[model samples]
Every structure is written in structure tokens, then in C-alpha cells.
Target: MKRRNFLQQTAMAGASLFTAGQSAAATPVYQQPADNPFNLNYAMHDGMFRNSAGADIIDQIKFAYDHGFRSIEDNGMMSRTPELQKKIGDTLQKLGMNMGVFVITSDNWHWKTSLTTGKQEWIDKMMTDCKTAVDVAKRCGAKWMTVVPGNFERSLSFEYQTANVIAALRKASAVLEPHGLVMVLEMLSDNPDLFLRHSDQAYMICKAVNSPACKMLFDMYHMQRNEGDIINNIDKSWEEIGYLQIGDNPGRKEPGTGEMNYKNIFKHIHEKGYKGILGMEHGISQKGQEGEQALIKAYRDADNFL
Candidate 1:
């Protein structure tokens, strides 16, 4: 099957998890930022896919840059060829765009294994993988890498699992700290059956790791699904949140398409002086290049309220 078809199917399977809610507070009619002062950045995975039209990846980078996104995130960045990585890094640097989080964990596929297993072999492998990820980050000048602690260990006690995750992260932090790399633990919402499903959980994990190299990747859509208090939860966990991601709840589409007032959220984060990228890890509501252009327009429109 084509890659897009596969992704659509994957999204559909995860769609039912979101319970419907009120549409985002009516765009909060307001004036725009002076020449757009919001410092928001968007992830490139879906947006680039929509705009590229099978264009070369470099052209895809140009497409996103022209569209007003100041950043990009690739979950599969580690899998890209070294040459491709260098090329993307060079292009992004030239455009003055930031490289956002890429995956550093082993459980990226349809598997279940927590990094907190506390197994010597697992810990060693993770450190080795993170060391490699650090090299990629160095080349791309990326600061954040996504780290999913993996699925719940049913065989172990919850306390044991937490301890294991903490130990593993402590070891992982050792690898990233010296290089000024951060591992942002993403609290995924798709698998509620697994661990790390809420902002509080992520906050606790960050606190436990207790290192600048360990922080939270607050994915807004996921957090909205896992817990509804968007603003309050952010306030509570602000200190540990190292990165932010965007996708509205219900549809997991562009911001305005669902129940998220991305404008106010952007305004809040911007006003708070969050310098990190807001990864646009979402899908376009429409199809193909038209949808891609629409996504850009939607960001411009929503961000105008800033």
C-alpha cells in the first residue's frame, strides 16, 4: 500500500480514542501580533508530506520554509541516510529554521517494551542509540529528541516500573547532558493501556530524572485527550516541558479544524517566552497540495489572534 494510505489507516484506528468536545472558543476575536511576534514552530512530517507532491525532500524543506513554519520534526529521522540528514540540516540552517525532536527509543514500531525495564542490556542499547542520536543532533544542530518510555510492564509492579524508567532515564541523561542534548519524554495518548498518558505523569518522570537533559515533550493533542485542562495543566507542568506539539483533539487535524483555540494557546506560550518549537504533528483535513496550502493558511489565521 502507499504510505499515505497506511498512515490514514493508522490514524483512523487511533481516532476513536478521542471523545468529542466543544469547538475551540470561537477564535477569540483579536488583533494580530505586530508583524507576527508569536515564536511558534511547526512540525514538518504531515505538512511536508501534504505539500511536497513527491518533490525532493530538499524542495519539501523549501516548501515548509516558504509557508511560515520555523521548524520541523521527523519521528524517523534516525532512519534517514546520513547524506540526507546532512542535506536537510544544511537547508534548515540556511533557512534559519530549527530542527525539532526525532525519535531515540527502540519501541517505535508496533511493539511493547518500556525503557524502564531496568535490564542491563536494554539500558546499554538505549544509551548506545542515544549516543548515535546525539551525533545526528550535532550534525543537524537539533536540541530535542523524543523518548517514549514504551508500554506498561504488566508483569511488573507499577512502583517497579517507575523505578526502572527512572533508572534508565538517569543513565540516558548521562549520555545527553555533556553534549547539551535533551530527551523529551512524550506522554502518548493513543495507548491509554500503556504508561505515561498524562502531563502529570510526564512531569513526575522529569522530576525524577532531575537533569536538564531530561524533560517533557508536551504534545497538546495527546494531553487534551488524556486530560482536558489545556492551560492549567501547562501551568502546572511548565517547568518540565521542554518541547510542545500541536494537533487538535477529535480529528488530529490542523489546529482550527477541531476543538483547540491554537491562537490563545500560542499567545499564552508566546507571552510566556517559550523558545521551543511547537511540533505540528498533525494531519491536513483536506487532500494533497490544496490541503497543505490550506494548513498554512489555517496557521496564519489562527496565529493572527496573537
Candidate 2:
């Protein structure tokens, strides 16, 4: 069944928010402050507001908009049916919000045929995924696609591995460039075996790809966990970076749940005048409507950096 149909079939699509400690008249779980817009485009994913909006992806988008969110990103969007994809695109267009990165090919998260392997089949898959991404972007008004270079090949020499990744990226870039879509490489902290693990490494790969379509994602949570020099690395790679993903370390939740000073970080990015989307890619720290409301307040608090 299409997600849209499943949503309508079950009332989960329109579940109302109730207070955590007190059950009052059903009220929205989140609402933006009177000041209206925040300084940056913090893109939220489907379940970020699910406690309030239930399982309806469209309702979640509407709830985010009502609370001042102006962008949405779904990493698994490519898997969504085209009709659902178009519905999401139309809804975002009507709200004048941005659509952020969806994964080009993340099936390699479990150590599959990575770019490092220099395998013909893997390279062909990369090209095919990039081509598929263009049509996906066209239907959904997306301008960015997330690309993970996959895990390192244990037997391959590091130099040859780097060369193979650059070659694959160049080919993928050709497919995305004409459509004005960017392929942003993400650095993961979930595993040490991953090929692309640092901001500078991604920056180097982006430079080697040498195309406007190639850029760095600069996910703060992973980088912070992998390497502690967050602000400095961000400054060094500022030019090559295209997007940002935020999560508090220790636990991958919204800001303030961990030790990182997101207020200062937000201030730094805003000071540099970054105009792209910063994806809230983490889970909520608290559960239910109260937790959802807390997540909005967290952004509000962090955005106070300006």
C-alpha cells in the first residue's frame, strides 16, 4: 500500500497532541514563537513530529510548518512510491519550503562493494543510482542527494582505494550536474571500517571529484565523535561543504542532550552566512508529545545564537 493510503486508512494520520502530565483539550504539540522564522533552514525528517502528527507524513510536514520549520529531508525518499513522492513535493512547494537530501545509495552501510574496492559492478551501481536520483529529484524538487562511499576494502591499498572513490564520484557527478542536483558525501561514526570517516577526507574526495555537483555533508555528530575539533574542521572545510546534519553526541538526539555547545556552533555557521539546510537527523530524547515539544524548544534555544 502507498504510504498515503495507509495514512488515511488509520487514524494514526491525525492523532492529536496531549500534554504529558495532564490531559487537556487536544492541542498542537509544537508551535513557533511570535518572532516567527529562525535564522537557519533546519530540515526535519518524518518521525521528528510524529508524536503530535501521528504516522501521516503529510500531517507531520504541516505540523513542522506551523511550528516554523521550513524544510524537510527524508533519507529513504527514493524508496517511497512516486505518487507519494509527488504529493510530498507538491505539499512542500505549497508551503514554500525546501526539500533536502535523500540517500542515493546507502545499501553499502553493511560493508558491501564500496568505491574502495575498485569493482566494475560497484561503479556501475553508483552511476545507476545517480541517474535514478535525478528523476527522484525532479519529482520531489530535491537539490541534494546523500552519497556514502561505503566501507574500506581490507586488501586494497589505501591509495588505490582513494583513486577508485574519486573515479566513481566523477561519473556520478556527471549524472547529477545537468539537473542542478548536488551529491553530498557523508562521514559516518557508526563504524570504524567505513571508507569516508572524516570531514577533511570528504573534503579531499570532493576536491578530487572536481565538480559543482560534488560537495561535503559535514555531519556534526559523527565528526564530533570521530574527531573533537568540530569548529576548527568546519572552518577549514567551509568552502567545500554544502550541507550540515546535527545531533548531540553521547546519544544521537536533538541539541542540548549532549555536551556540544550547539548555540555557539549555530552562531558560527550563521556568522559564516550558511544558507543551506541543516538536517535534524537525530531521534528525540524524550518520548511522546512532551518530547516532541521539547525538540522544537531545543531548536529555538539553539537558534538563539545569532
Clashes of each: 1, 0
* Top-scoring candidate (lDDT): 2
Candidate 1 positional error at 61, Å: 1.1
Question: What tens-digit string does per-residue lDDT give for candidate 1 at 1-306?
Answer: 222243445344333332232122112123233234335766676224432323355755665665556778777678778888888889889888889988886445213565656677777778888889988997776889988777777888888989998998998899999999999988877755567788988899899889999999998998888888898899999999999988887888888998889899888888888877888777767754446557777888777754
lDDT of 2 by residue, 44-116 (tens): 8876776676567898888788888999998888888999999999999998899998888845332564788
Ten-residue segment with the worst summed lDDT in candidate 1? 22-31
TM-scores of the candidates in the order shown: 0.85, 0.90
Model 2: which residue pairs collide? none
Q: Which stretches of candidate 2 lie over 4 Å from their true place?
A: 1-26, 33-35, 106-111
Best by TM-score: 2
Q: Give the TM-score of candidate 1.
A: 0.85
